[model samples]
Target: MAAPALSPLARIAREQDPDRFLCALFAPAERREALFALIAYNAELARARAMASRPMAALIRLQWWRDTVAEAAARPPPRHEVAGPLAMAIRAGALDPADLAAMADAREAETEELPFPTREGFHAYLRGTAGRFAIAAGRLLGAPAEALPGLEARGVAYGAAGVLRAAPALARQGRCLLPADLLAAHGLSAEAAARDPGAPAWRALARDLLDGGGLAAPPAGRLPAAWIAAALPAVLARRDARRLRRSGLAAPPRPGRPLADRLAVTWAALRRRA
Candidate 1:
């Protein structure tokens, strides 16, 4: 007989985005599954809030996710289908409840209009959210907490780069992910920043933020190395940003990396985890 149907939560964890699911490769056994599920829940909640719908049900569901994650229980058979993997992982080892709460808090902030006034503000948001989670993941992999700040830095940098890489799509959502004031302080508007990011003023802002990301890099050869692997995408985005003058606000298209290749990366990472 066939196995029971996957719950809505499990579907979010396993079937939402194949690319995101594939990122589980970077973590060890317990944390990898747990992280995937955590991110899945987050993505589902974020998607729900992106509000492609006019119905009240969507808002109600969003509120439920907000409440559940914001108040995750200490003991559980697993709260929801989405949080179950994390629950199991937390039980196994090193899933600090604070780390989970921190992430939820960040997402809650994201649901509101952003209030970043400077590049520093952008960095703070990135670090508080993604950087913190990456640090916790590094810790779960047995890296010390002191080592986390470095990894956290890389995570914040990467989060910024990811936004830049997805700038076009983000703009489509009516969100300008770039810290515009960094550009505006030098007399650039959002339109100007996006139209020709290679302009001296635009490039200056990019250069500053790009350089700031260097502060976030991990210690050389620390803990399985793959934990720092997300750095590659950020590095690529920075290099491309230098040439972004002609492109303006347009984000580069997703690179054509194949599934088989990603699977190979996953296999290698898992082997290290083992």
Candidate 2:
């Protein structure tokens, strides 16, 4: 059953994700196409199961995504699907197959309760899970592979910061992404956060995360120096917006960032890679 779910991996491989494909287009056309499929498959996996239900079920489902990656590769990467893009990325850059698999692991962490002993622990998770992903993107854009470790540090910080900023809204899914200890330190319970919209600790946490992320610099590198730069500011702005919402005690919008504006921004950024 799991092996077959991989079919979407193939289908998604062929179909283009506007943001990723467009970003890739900014680089060498030969280079961009290779990574688009890899990114698309990961996106598909996230879409396949939007939120958590049971940890056991979520873990099993995550395994399926991992298997899908394997199954897709069992045969030659499809003509235009994720496999081919990944194949190209591997040839042109320093991406590791297992690094992509790490994303699935990160998703699994969300399935169960997230408990970071300290903020540092949370940062570590962000780097391994999200930082590496940014590095993979950077690699496709012609950044040096050796630079990934430091760059990963910065990318993960941004990711953790984003998640922290969004903590209030994300709790709606009945899971908390921030460290439970941090919330407890502020005298809030995860249960209270999910149920109590007025929780001060939630806002405080969001403020800290946004400030932390906003003050942090994007790593000095060829990747963000090029196309990733276009994307980074927007990511920061989003973190800022979420921080504002949390601080203002405003509820998350029933509908998020308007699509038209988003499309415009995404397209414009991709076109301006430098």
Candidate 3:
């Protein structure tokens, strides 16, 4: 038989945010659409800065999403492909408006086009963006309250790895997400790193961040199977970190091998560990 058609949000999730899309497939059937809607919503926010004509325009786009989430509880969301289903997820109490708003709020930093001021600031950005998303997904998947800490830790690690992976692209855009202080400590500046992402210094810097960025796996037993599914991006993060360690930041980041990702995610899910 031919495959069934994807919903609009599902198509967006699969195309733009494949890692989360893969993980969402492990969610219960009844909750999968809501998960896809949430991932599509995030993908939209992530692209807002790049899609805009200027920084101000990017901020305006983010504000529109923030307003949409804030008003979703009281009125119908704008007739947007992602927004409509996201609002439905919120209304059904499967997604949290506050968390969605925080995720959007975190992206506001991208409008500045500068490196993060401090390591704490960088981690905070990760916590607010990816961390919040994981928590929301876990809640939708019925993760217990106790799973929150592990979920947040793993999410932050995934965010850190993602920043490293996107370094080259961000450089091309005249932006750098690495902490300014750390860059300076390695005798590199944001402008310099942005100009030469392959500098040997960047390799050292990438290692420092990977070692200290809390990419360590969380305790195995703390999360349930559903929570593991929600935090599967962490598994990918670990794999990326390993590759970065082996090849250094001088190498361009490559797309994850689909079969390998599937096998790893499937193993993690079946083992009930992230």
Candidate 4:
């Protein structure tokens, strides 16, 4: 017999945000829908800039999400596919409205299409966006308060790798995420880096970012299996970092093999590490 069809939110997550979707599958069955809802909502926020033709339009869309999150706290969210499920997730205590709002606010930087002025600013962006998302996911999986720090560290590392992986696309969009200070140190400008992402200067900068964003693996027995599952995407992030190190930032990321990804996550989960 064939498998049942995925829910609308699940479909969105599986297609648009496969890494988080895969991690969500490791969550308890009862919590999977709520996790999917969060992933779908995040996917929507991540694409808001791309969906809008103008910077103001993208900010407007982000504002709508910020409003929706606030509204979800009091009553039903706006009627929409992802919004309704996200509000449900929020109401069910599976997600945090504050985290959702912060995620939306983080994307507001993207609309400006400006390179980060400093390394600290870049990492701050990762913390507010990916770090917060990881914390929210960990909480959903019943992770303890003590585990939040580890999750945030791993998530920031994952976010750094993600920026590297997204370099090619961002370049095509005429945006550069490389820190301005680093670019200047390497005798390159943001426009130059964006135009030639394959340049050796960019590769060196990629290495610098990766080195600074190293994953902090938790000690064995420090976390439960559920917490490990929540941070499993850090495994993939490490893998992608290795690939970029080998091939340079200019190389388009190869699609991850599903079997390999599942095995990696399973192994990490079994070891109770991220």
Candidate 5:
């Protein structure tokens, strides 16, 4: 069967996750739409949390996605933009409803005031959400269970970097994803750090998390060549994490920086670094 047509959610995914979108260009031509379906579905769930003013509001929105997935499982695809194409991917065996639900459930943590109490707690959250997303994408790209441990490592690294990079924006929304213990160790409060992104303690903490938290490691072992393209975004994540360590949580570079980032991603894909 042919891949589903690109939906509006595909545009949102391209805008929201340009790195992965760029990397997806390297996937087999026919499978690219399914990849976009996965990315778009993820973007839709993430937007649910970002747009919510309260945890309950976010939960309500997330539940809609959950129920839609369930209904899609039982009968027909939901008529919504993201859900329909997502259902196409599910039927094609490129998407898993279980992983979709897990990602949505894990994202509820975004609505909480202090989502992660410890570094390990944050890692667990990343594993369930972003890490799971990576493994699913890996499977779509034809990687097996043996490849998951490495993919999970890349996922956690990329997810943690993304959280750190969004610290300022998250702070504005009165949410903090940084582990409480890390902030405490640095004698920093989320409010104070948010107000002054260049604070010494914030820099120290950022540096430690990016450098010592295993965010720098590339994926290990032999992987499907297609998986290198799928995982190449983690290389950019490492680059951004390192930059955040030095410069603190400044605004991220605009995505799809075709000249620099695409070249970098291409190089990383060739090298099979992640």
Candidate 6:
């Protein structure tokens, strides 16, 4: 007999974020759908900002997801494909609505023209959204409470790297993610960075951001099997951060061949590395 088809949420996850989806494969089968659902929902939230043509459009779409989360809180078995599975994960993982809601709230920053006013502000934004997602993912993966700080750091690294990778695209949209103080310190304006991504000042700022992005050094020894799987994105993020610094925004890192990425994750899981 043939294998069953993936649900809508699973396909969203597998198609939109193959790296994290590949890592989730290490999770037990019965729990995999919940993981996919959580990731897919996050992708949806992210896409709201990525796909919107205007800030108002992004706000409208984000509001929709926020409302969906509210409705899901009031009632189980949400109506949409992504929401339904997300609701299940919420219940199964005992996730807090406030945390999920905060993720949506933080995404509002993405729609703004000048989002990160300061370095500390940028870090706080990342912690609220990406760091929060890591905590939620760890909970679903059955991570111990003691492991959360590590997971949160890993998430911050991935989130910062992801944002830095999107710098070119964001620049084209006439928006910048770099902190205002960093841009000022380098004597580079957002317009200048957007217009000439290859400029020396812009490259210097990118290198600085990548260096301070909170990408923790890999653990010296093996981690637990579950954590190793859950932290795979951080591994990929570190590679991306390095590439972003070396290559600049014009040549951000690619996801690489899917097979290679999956193999690397599998090796990491087997060896219990991040």
Model number with the top TM-score = 3
The C-alpha TM-scores of every prediction are 0.68, 0.67, 0.92, 0.90, 0.89, 0.87
Q: Compared with the true structure, what per-residue lDDT tens digits does model 5 show for residues 146-221?
A: 8777787787778888888778877886778899988888887777656887766777888887677655547433
lDDT of 6 by residue, 88-176 (tens): 66665555567688889988888887858898989888888778888777877778999878888888888887776677667777878
Error of 5 at 207 (Å): 2.4
> If ranked by lDDT, best first, what sequence of candidates would result?
3, 4, 5, 6, 2, 1
Per-model CA lDDT versus the true structure = 0.54, 0.55, 0.81, 0.78, 0.76, 0.75
* Candidate 2 least-lDDT 10 residues: 213-222
* Each candidate: RMSD: 5.5, 6.9, 2.0, 2.4, 3.3, 2.6
**lDDT, residue 53, model 4:** 96
Tens-digit lDDT string for candidate 1 (1-274): 9976644644665565444345554555445556665567556655664664442545566566555544455556455566666566666665666666666556544454443666766777677666766666666666665667666765665566555555555545555656656656667655553455446665455556666434333323324554543322233333344444334444444554345446544554444321
- Which candidate number maximizes lDDT? 3
> If both were scored by lDDT, which would come out higher, candidate 1 or candidate 4?
4
lDDT of 4 by residue, 65-163 (tens): 888888886986778989998888888888988888998999887888688998888888888888888888888889888888888877887788788
Worst 10 residues of 5 by lDDT: 215-224
How displaced is residue 237 in candidate 5, in Å?
1.6
Question: What lDDT is reached at residue 217 by model 3?
Answer: 48
What C-alpha lDDT, on a 0 to 100 scale, does residue 195 get in candidate 5?
89
Q: What's model 1's TM-score?
A: 0.68
lDDT of 3: 0.81
Model 6, residue pairs in steric clash:
none
Query: Which segments of candidate 3 are over 4 A away from where they belong?
Result: 1-3, 191-200, 219-222, 252-258
Model 3, residue 207: C-alpha shift (Å): 2.3
Q: Which scores higher on TM-score, 2 or 6?
A: 6
> How does candidate 4 fare on TM-score?
0.90
